[model samples]
Target: MSKLNIDQKKIKQLFEDKRSDFLIPDYQRPYAWGEDECQTLWKDIFNFAFPDKELEKFNSDEEYFLGPIVTFENNKKLEVIDGQQRLTTLMLLLRVFYKRLEKMKDENSMRTKQNLAQCIWKSDEFGNENKEKLKIDSQVALDEHKNEFLEILKTGDAKDFKSQYAINFRYFEKEVDEFLKEYPSYFAYLPTRILNNCILLPIEADNEKTALRIFSTLNDRGKPLADADIFKAQFYKFYVAKNQKDEFIEKWKNLEILCKEVFSKKDNTSTDEIFNRYMYYQRALKGNKNSTTEGLRDFYEKDSYALLKSDRTFEDLQNLGSFWQAISIQDKNYFDENTLRWLFILNYAPNIMWANITSVYFMKNRDEQNQLDNIKFAKFLEKITAFIFAYSFIYPSVSQLRIPIYSAMIDIINDKEMDFSKFLFEKENLKTFIQN
Candidate 1:
């Protein structure tokens, strides 16, 4: 790999000379710079190269600097690996400069205008007139790239650039016309200076694989990365650290296994769809309660007890194991059940109804000693689960069936002589109450 010394002129020259050589491919996502970013870049460049000459006006010593232009080798073609934002912004600045020059009748203005025009808007073999025209020629290409520029111009506000280019371009022309009236001089010279002054750092590698590594590192260092991005990195590390890609893949493969096992018995719905619906239900419940569904999906997907195996710590695993142990002791028939019965009951029931049921049950079985016992606690959990499932199935369309079910469950719990069988097994009165 060879090191290339690059300055503003050299960088501008490369862009000017090789318009076709520097292609942002079909796979690359659209330019996403909004008004704030574009404005910030403009201000930063203006402050840097053309610092205030007046001492009183110069407030700070902090120097403004633009980022490097990232390019990759595509055989003889140099693909823009990064820095598309800066390049596109510079292009806009140049266009603005040209517009400003065209307004001036002076010879100097004409000369500067010709220089700027020749740099970015030279005619091609097919007589394609200018950069602006070529940019909007194809809808597919425009949608992929140049739409943002058109949008910033159209709304005169960076926020209103919808997914269409024609709408945005109309605004762009309007903005250019308006901008020329106020800061004609600054517009003419500022863009040309920015194009001729900014620096570019070209990252070179022997192969595309190495270049991609450099590209990834460059991106990682700059932006505020996403949680999903961090998770992918952690996942890669976890795979390498354990040397168990297959094990991880197997775990993911079996993620829906518990869903299938539990839902398969009913045979009324697809387990995958039901599990998705169950998650959506959890989100809705959480949102209804707290106006946010934060960490509910995460809890369902990644934090569930059944997936962790023996790797979970003793304390964490102990609590989870105890819950399952209690369930086993209470229901003796279903040992391998992964169903979180208590959670499901609370989740399915209306908030107020669930609260009432909880209060009644906890009040009746308030003894500290009995509460700690796995078998006893499990029986209470099972009763709640059975109550919820029975109510939900019996009154499938009713929005607030939890009120009646909670009342019945509380009554049954309080009255020792009142048989649970009467409410659950009889089903007719309970079903009628739930339906009504």
Candidate 2:
């Protein structure tokens, strides 16, 4: 929690001399900060160095300041816990500085370049036997650091890096080359001396645990965190507790597979969004027809009924089969996998009208009622079908209307003396419902 005051000179020196003392473990995710983030950091340092000019406004102070440098005491080494992006970017800038200094033949520039190089590239030799352990000579390590620097130079846009920083390295390089052709004194002073900077707040904490915590909280005040990020945090909590990281990952993979197989057939659907939506819908209904749209975005994003296919459990599979059975009785000819899949919505309704029609017929005679006799249920089926079609095709809006429409249809079915066939063909109701 203590603030270590490492200014620009000290920062440059530390990177040049002590860079070999820091090592990023393979456990850390690969540096994925794109050009925009890199440019932003450059702009932040530029503004910090030269705050006088009314430069373009930044989104926030935090955006202007790099978060923190966390130093972790490993068995014998100091591990950098956070701010790797900034640190890596600074190293690239130093490389550029070193190259420019070498071209200039200025003793002062040469001395500064050597100092920066020693800070970033040198390792203290403990003994002849232990030299390799502390040194920064491994091919893998060199390639990674080199690639990190190259990625910044290659990807960063000139306008973003220059306008924000008030100095374009590419432009500076070209200008210096031209000037050296003439005046040559331009190389005597290193650009690093002109750029004032401050080291990020250094936090000392248990390395791995503190890194996760700081990363999570770093941008909390900015745009909301993604669900995937939150899920990863939660997953890690349970995973670490049980020492079942592998098992947790496997379960997530299994859920992903189930989700993909079930919802992939649906048109224009996102699997993750759909799974989240279905979960919300189930919680919303709670075995009742009434549910709110508060979290409905999750389920509506996917075809809920289609997802039933992925359930391997006996009870879930049976419920899915029963749902299809009801759909078959209603529209025998229209009974395809797609139509049957759509029937899962009925399970959300209070009254299972299709199930009721099938039940009544089975009760009347031991033999299944002929399709002709089932004609009496046609009107009931028609009303249900019309409403569903309207909801799915015509309106297609998720709202309170679903409950009322289902409720009205259920009432019609419950009237024992009412003939569904006669009621469905009634011109008045059809016109009224359609118009409304």
Candidate 3:
């Protein structure tokens, strides 16, 4: 049982020292704050900071609660599990203030600038800041995402306003200028108020498991999390334990990009789609065809997330991602025309079981050259298509097709000479299936 270290601290207190380095892992969502969220935060903090009183002195007891951040210590850094959006937005806001203070040489302005610098960068004993070492890092998989935030923080602004980092930073700048225009005398106090008054509850867990459990429990009613996020956390833990965390991060980023490009998304992410497909492959390997399929999270989370801890699981997933990408883009270098045609037909099938079964077969049979056994693949697809359609019409209910498909998938996994006839309907049922 790991103990959680819970502490409530002011915003400046959380990030004012070199000890406060924060890392948002690769699996978390990128910064998503838009104008509305920034506006609401700005309004609340500004009102709290000013209090509609004479600007000379604010009540020392006044504090604005800025919610909580969940993190665990990893390799001497705080790996953020939750509250990255707020953490990121605050950094942008603070950077904006730091940049604004640069133009003013007044004692208050310079002092506020120094405090903000300590929050944004690693400072020396002499109070000089190391611009190279930012206090926070977001490792989200978007291209140049981490660099973009760093660049925005190091420099005053960004030309590419497309990023939420840039957008929110610019928004804060605009809000700051508007405030300066309205209250020139009070502008210097704004940063002080925000840094000293804004508060965040820091929930630090002793391990990633505890951190993730806390994350899931907290978000149960707030926002639905994708199953892939939990799986990624498990993989992160496994890879980190092996000292291969950097390698895993790169592979996971590629997986994210590939899945988003190649897989279909209804409600789930492309990563989720890949996992969902691979779940069938695992089921087949276990030869547990009789058990009903479970929800994606529940399936992967069995035995304390035992499935994701294996290196083979992730390797198979990478191969599966590549296989699906080929199918999606019709990569002629790897897949023949006949196979693609059958895959097209299978895509239109009433249920996704056909595709899931095909994923299992691909994992078992895919060659080192990354090419499918084209003749076998085409033949397999044709048979599976016919079998799935026939079963669909005869059974009508989706669950009725699972046991047979699951059995066929097991046979595929074991490299058995598939007897497609075993999966076919009886002659009378076949006649009824075709007639309908």
Who wins the lDDT comparison? 3
Q: Comparing candidate 1 with candidate 2, which one achieves the higher TM-score?
A: 1
TM-score ranking from best candidate downward: 3, 1, 2
lDDT of 2 by residue, 330-404 (tens): 455634444444454454544333343333322222233222233444444455555544444333454534454
TM-score of 3: 0.68
Candidate 2 vs candidate 3: the TM-score winner is 3
The alpha-carbon root-mean-square deviation between model 2 and the true structure, to one decimal in Å, is 13.9
Worst 10 residues of 3 by lDDT: 138-147
Among these predicted structures, which one has the highest TM-score?
3
Instruction: Return the TM-score for each candidate structure.
Output: 0.41, 0.40, 0.68
lDDT for each candidate structure = 0.45, 0.42, 0.84
- Per-residue error for 366 in candidate 2, Å, reads 34
- What are the RMSDs of all candidates, in order? 19.0, 13.9, 6.0
- In model 1, the runs with Cα more than 4 Å from the true position are 1-11, 53-65, 122-187, 204-207, 223-436
Residue-by-residue lDDT tens digits, candidate 1, 72-153: 5565555565566566655556555565566688776776676665555545665444544322111112133355654443
RMSD of 3: 6.0
Model 3 CA lDDT for position 32: 75
The residue-by-residue lDDT of candidate 3 on 87-177, one tens digit each, is 9899999999898889898899989999999999998899799998899987664334667888898876777756778888888989999
